[model samples]
Target chain A: MSRRTSRWSVAFVAAVLTSGVGVLLADPHLVLLSIPAVVFAVYPHLTRPPAATLEIERSIAEQDPAHGQEVEVTVTLRNAGDRTLSDVRVVDGVAPMLSVRSGSARHAAVLGPGTETTFSYTVIAKRGVHRFEPATAVLRDASGGVTLETTLAADTELACRSPIRTLPLGHTARYAGSTATTDSGSGIEFSRIRSYRPGDPPGRIDWNRYARSGELTTVSFREERSRTTVCCLDAREICYRSSGDDSVHAVSYERAAARELLDAASDAGEPVGVAIFGVDFTWLAPATGSHHVATAHRTLEDPETLPIVPPTEWDGTPDDAQARELRTRIGPPTTVLLLSPLLDEFPLETARTLRAEGHSVTVLSPDVTTAGSLGRGVARLRRENRIDALRRAGVPVVDWEPETPLETAIRRGERR
Target chain B: MTGPIAIARRLLVGVGAVALCLGLLVLFGPPVESAIRWPWDDELLLVAFFTAALLLASVIGPFVLIDDGSQNQNQNQNRNRNQNRGNASPGAPERVPSTPTPGRELERVLDSRWPASLPPVRRRRIRRRLRRAAIRSIVRTSNCSKETARERLERGVWTDDPVAAAFVRAGGGPDSDSSRLRSLVERIRFPRRARRTARAVLSRTEEGEHR
Candidate 1:
């Protein structure tokens, strides 16, 4: 019901009416000039809304893609009504986080009855699931006087999954796994023979030794205990800095390493938990099972539970409340795998405090500091100094370079 | 000269001139007196009127035809040129910038190795870094404030190169434009399909010449 007056029509109508009246009363010469104005005034009404029948269908090239892969989305619009649409502008609603890699999500075309047009664009897949919104189409008549905006709903989902890889635990996890444990017991390696006890297992009785030595002895193997590890991620504001790309951010690397460690620990039948310290403050208690693994994945994937950006500045001072909170959550028998960029002194102090509290500490610091500029060079030096100080204090520290895989870095750190 | 209004004006001037000449001839010449005293009533007057109208039409007709012919020729020429531009090859010399000085720094910043296959988060970070650097470079070189430079860059005021300008505007993020630019740059740099596009572009211009 919305109507807009055309300026040309208004001007022409006014001129014709005034001239026609003047000619009737005074001069007949101006009567012939009003003929063109009458024709101009009738031209606009010839255009109609192009009947309201349109069918929109959306299709995605890949519903599930690896992170960093490109997905192409095509939207096909057909004119179902019995009319020709002169000017139609269609804009497909692309997810905000998904970047268009190629082509365009918009198209302008003229479609006749039963004719179809399609517009497509490529989007870079990121981690998480993205849903497409409705496409908006604006139909304009031939005279450009009438515009009808219609929203067409198109439901599509694109899920980007990150491939999980096992991270090298090195000498940290003492259990029966790919990595060897320092204190080996009940393993393949033979240890020593001890005097047989009355209730000793029949299999452990060294019959060959007893036959040779004539003294009753029992074979004892070193007992291998599955290592229970808690991954402590420092998602504090100070750990949010990136050397170059956001993907190369300190916290992102820490998160990746933590996930890998959790996967490796879970595979080895070791109890693993995650504690994210920041504004979000997410803590998962030590547990082992498929349910716990699913819970960890869910927590890591949820945007609310993870810190994407720094919420506050780290002043390099100790927060007693935070330390106390961490201490209460972490048990004594569990090894604390502290993953931080160690951007400031606070994380270093936290590592020191954890070690002092009799918890075995392994610090995996992702190096996001570059020495391209003096400021960054100083930051790198400060980070190195912190790593040195932590190592000197008997804490196993892994200073991982961003380019190196997490597993390789941990193995290298263990060897050192 | 070729428009409908121009043709109408020419026709009006031609008719006015013919009418004025006829009026002068009738006022001073013996033809008008002879025609007035003719035994055949108004037959002579009708013939003179028809003769004058024919003369006016003859004088104005050629100009109108010539104008129309020339207008059609010009339109055909323009259409051909547009078609040629649209069909130009990827290595077309015209696609290369004439003087790439303004975009040199931005190009260098964007020239960093950003592959499309990298994770979306990494790609976004790389794009953002390149964009910020480009904006800062624009501010420094153009002697404008950061806000003005950003606005200009976003609006594509600094560079005429659409891809380079788009690269600046699509600051590292998950937006469609940024993603498109990143993909374009990756293709241009690595070029699995169009491998010669980058080589053809760079080989034509000297590297230091841009600086």
Candidate 2:
């Protein structure tokens, strides 16, 4: 605790000096004036602040909350000493990123021995893990002449989970894979009957048809095989736009869609890989496993890997260098699922180039453009035209709306 | 700091006490002259008695006033404490309460509102906030990432608008030097429009000067 002389004390000293001088000059009036000063001087000393006896504790309502949810926090302070504490102030150390939604995180009260006070507040949680710092307490004497400050360490952590959901995939595979194929083969789903060859197994023979027509025939079943797939997400700056608050930026949607596709591919025992283009080129070769799926999620979720900001300038049009890089990284029997907002011509050109390289390409374009303004309308028209051009080139395009869920949009597109 | 009124009151009280002492001395002077043999000795004896009475009054008068004032103050304080306790929820911990300090409240406000993670210096904070805002706007307008925006800014790609680039290069870290420029940049409603207007004004002024 630190102490500073109060104005009352100073006034008393001045009064004493004046009275002494008056006495030396044989003045009785000055001696009368000094009486009040003496009383004021001694009054504060009679009732000084007591020794340290304050204790503090803090509690949080929820340790982990969903993103955008509010969490309430309470801080309690008690004085255990015999002397009354006239003034106490407490400030709770809230995380920087999380904003206090309602109520104050600070409180002040006067307490006697064995008395306590509590303050409560609420904060809106954000994505990621947040840790609370210690609470600070400032105590003062009744006279306000002395103050003692201390920090009460109460550490707590809150973790918020991601809001995105997994996406669904269609049964059709452009390339050979372990997943079910449309082609007829020896599989669970029935296909068609055909003329029996010499090498045909007897179990595949259609006995009922054979008995009716007096001919030997074999039944065909749909084939089930795994295909190598690559999910490429466009992290270009153009894809960072969002049309609504509930909707994330186009790049985030793309990442979510790619993650779902990669996870589905991995679960189906197919070799799947991921690539990101725009801010900085990143690629993971096609591989299938739980580890690979986790790796892909980490890469897609990494802000550094897929930056929210767009590049200031275009690197160049989709040229031979980009096509060469694609060819080098991706080999045949690999189907490419290109996730982009397709805001600019470069993404469309890149898709066409990838298709030209004989890869079965499907573009999952997250539509971030809104026709609320003339500029946005023009941009939307341009995007539609690009999608049309891609469709004309025989590439299936899923024009995913920003507000629509990825699973619903992909399923609807697959039906078409 | 004590106000003028308080000082005036104290001065008035001192003068009144002195006047009362002088009056008492004058009232008792004749009685003292009748009792003493010497004429000057009577005045001295009266003065001494007046001084003693004044001294006794000075001590006793303050004590009585102080005792009465303290009693009232204590009663009021106890009432307030009881009211405060009643306001709190039942079974809640007792609290030591005090009025909020204005200076400390202001400090807390500054601490909470200011970006603590950023550089502590005011000019540096301004520079960083402005730079980040400019970069974000560039990313939005140009459809580029933060890296590309920073690169373009450093290279002066937005030559049509030099304020942002100039701000980046304005090396002074002191608030006195940077605040004016910071405000100027912040006030630009539409950067592109402001740039065009600035160019037009400069060209018009040049033409007028040449003519």
Candidate 3:
């Protein structure tokens, strides 16, 4: 529409005048000008009129989304223009990479001038910033004639980077290496002995000294240190993750779960390491550290490649070899937290390999069953039994049905 | 927007069109009936006169009044004055009287079967096209066209387009012997009528029409 802009403007004027003047002059020779005019006429394809002055209001169903919860994003497009529009297409740019599960997010509506069309499209929330670009609005004249494409500038962006659920650490270890006398919680290592306070636990009373001094005194012990634990993430197949609402964006949730897990482990003074597997032709092995956490955070922000690589023509198949390579690199005695949609075999072997290596394996398999419970019912049950078989082989498994919170999974783990 | 206005306009337009058609038949249609024997004397002169009258009426018939309980007496006059600018062509100068330099040119050549002399229009377009071809030959000399030719030694895009290469080789653009030999190669590849895109992008560093 650049140089053609000027030519088209001229063509429009020339076409009408030449045709009008030709009829008046009764001269068909003016039709020569019609040739180019006809070509220009073909360009302005018919589309809905621009929503120049449109009032757009958007809302989500709830404030919070459980692990794989699906939320509906109701976007009401009010055509404030004083003109009728045909073939209106609306795409709600949701956070992360969750696609519309059930409802038609893209719509073509016929609205009279001033009337509004309310479109409801369901979006299952994933982790990260889902910035909504202004809706692309295209309006064409009735004859499939002049068409105008304008971006509705009044776009609303909603971001939801929810924290992954973490189980309460079996133990919290402390490290100070301080010799200074201080009154604190007791450990096997002696911290300090101070005058007993009323609320002091009877176990730390030091009975012999209490009788001798005739006054209450408590002996505090120094906090202990345990082995530094590393939690390596097996996140190669976030793409195939499907939710209870049949959303593929559940991959971001798995990422959020990974990040939240690192935070919980770090809270317990466990050194955490994260690795994002199955990215590209060369799978990246981001070393574990505070920096690794930040890198993982950045990777988690995008549901797709995390800008790890520009999108190529991906066949949408899992990288099994890369996953195996990652499985082989697990640090000894590290807690292997593997998350997947269970739609493939790469993740199953990863957890099995970790368990076989004698590392504690915790599997969070997000179920991506088919819709209507027809073909998915038997298949989903069989996969659950397969995970149970893994658990019997000495791996702790967490059944992650989409929308069921991580807390529910944790409680189930605890019962097991 | 309603049925009445739409219906009335339809009727008026329909009636006017019918009247115009009948007038056309009387005027433009051949008067074969006048040649045949009939109840009344079929005079050739009379038929010709009637036909002329019909022609006159056909011209005036449309300008005649349309009756939909409304007056279109001044509609044509109003349209003539207000003439919808949206429908009319604008008066703008042709930009890129040619396609953008050599890429488009190469794409065009590859897409379409090679042809003879390019369309003629503005002198600037032809010059621009040649310049673009020269630049392409000079730049992509190794990959695009033969680099041995003097013109190709100068620029490759020009040599890439068989027609432009020949023009430059036949002592057209440059006067070198190697350039002439390169021109020979161009003629062998392209027909006399078949034209290649001119990739004239040398004088200007900007990306524009090239062969």
Candidate 4:
């Protein structure tokens, strides 16, 4: 919109207007010719669509799904104007980690009467805060007139979390006197009490009970440690996506859970560790102190590229040696919390193996499998089977669909 | 290809548009000659409408060319590739940007040949993505034929997208696309299946008992 004056256009217009009276007025031929030329050449730019007028909205068909499932995205295109929109194409900019299929971004539509059109597509996200930016609708007149580009930052987001596991924490691990043990040393609930054994500790002995029992019967109350387990998410390109500017719900979601878990653990002073499975493992050995929790957070935050040594349990290759080596090098097992999409068998098997080795395993996998309408049933079945196996193996499971609050799922499962 | 199709189509739509515009123009334009009256010189009006229609189309000719978005695909891919790789730290040459990577010692891609000249930033991005993709592809790929590997790539099945996109985008210049990258990844000299098989066999209990 520099002045409506091109030098030639201005000169021509000036000649037509200021060429005073008789002789110029006589030659009206020039005026008609000039009008059509200018109109034809300049109409497009003048008629270009307004950038501010376009609005976009997006909805995730299912705000939640199992890992590796597809999620449908329904995008609404609204014309907030009096102008007839032609050649309006809308592309919902997706995060790089998602796989989008079907149809082109450039929609062919003639929306004139306060119109709204919606385009539906599907994608499978790993796990995390999946942001949906505004749809970029590139509008041009049917005659390729001035092209107008609109960017609507609608700020739509969907949070994908893992599925629930039925097994309790004790299923993942075992305690000799767990039943009457009251499991009080560190857990989420109150179990029970037990009689003093031969090696009764004076600190834990119920003095009141001792006075009554006529013997030193140590009062063993179930230890209620924080159900806070922080996972260390590996955001490095290799673990999930390979390149730069890539995002996977698995990476982001795992990182997100890890962050929350670490925060909760830190506040509650519980042990936390993360075994990053990328090219290798980035192990933050489980420690109970708040400092260790902070370390887990920092490790999760590290900008990815660092070489990671994966814990042996989740090794992609059927190589148990690595898992054996990791197991040997590791200290006392805390809860083995695996935050992944579980696209492959590695993470699941890792959880199973951890349980087999006397470690409590909790899997937080974002349900990518049950995202869309058609495949949801099958995905649900698969998810059910996975949960069943973990439960049968005595590992507590928490199945989460995307967009459902992770905390709610964790609490419900624990209570159950 | 792009504009004026609507207007042209409308006019040619028989009585609906032709009669409308011509009726208006004939009622309005200055008298050409006595042969053409102010209101109802049917032949003259027809001629005038046709002439105007031809003139408008001829005037709008050049602008009709549609610039298919294909032209910009390469430029976008290259720019993104570089932006991604440059973000990785220098010390970790094989580092992928987002999903984890820290491991002790591992076999590098072993590319002694200097890669074709590319913008340094883009090259770095490609290299990083390639490294990450290589590892991930190795992990994801079952020990199968080159055809199977290629099929997986074509399906866009890998979990690591940035690396895959970069690898695919970087392998071919303007001529490259996702399909092309899929093929190239399959052909990448590493016998990825062999390594995986070796690792698996070495880990198997049967083999372990012998060891």
Show where candidate 1 strays beyond 4 Å. A1-225, A245-248, A309-319, B1-211
For model 1, report the TM-score of its A chain: 0.59
Could you give the interface RMSD of each candidate, to one decimal? 18.9, 19.8, 23.6, 17.5
- Predictions in order: lDDT: 0.60, 0.59, 0.48, 0.47
lDDT of 3 by residue, A346-384 (tens): 566777876677766677766655433222332343354
Q: Give the better candidate number (1 or 3) by DockQ.
A: 1
User: What tier of docking accuracy does candidate 4 attain?
Assistant: incorrect
Error of 1 at A152 (Å): 10
Per-candidate interface DockQ score: 0.01, 0.02, 0.01, 0.04
Tens digit of lDDT per residue, candidate 1, span A1-416?
23333424443544455454533343223433444454454445544645556678988898777666778888899999888999887766564345666888778989999999987888777554555546656677877665566667767777663333443332355443433456635665577878988988888888897889788897766655566678888876567666553233566567666666777777777788888776546789988897998798677645455533333334432455666778898866568888888866677788888878887788898887764432344345446656766766778788887566555677687777
lDDT of 4 by residue, B1-211 (tens): 2467455544445543444455445447546333343343465554555455445554433323222334245324433332233343211111112442211011222222322233434434434433333333323334344456445444544333433333433232233345866545544523232223223322231232344
TM-score of 2: 0.40
Candidate 1, fnat value?
0.00
DockQ-derived CAPRI band for the predicted complex in model 2: incorrect
* Model 3 chain A weakest 10-residue run by lDDT: A1-10
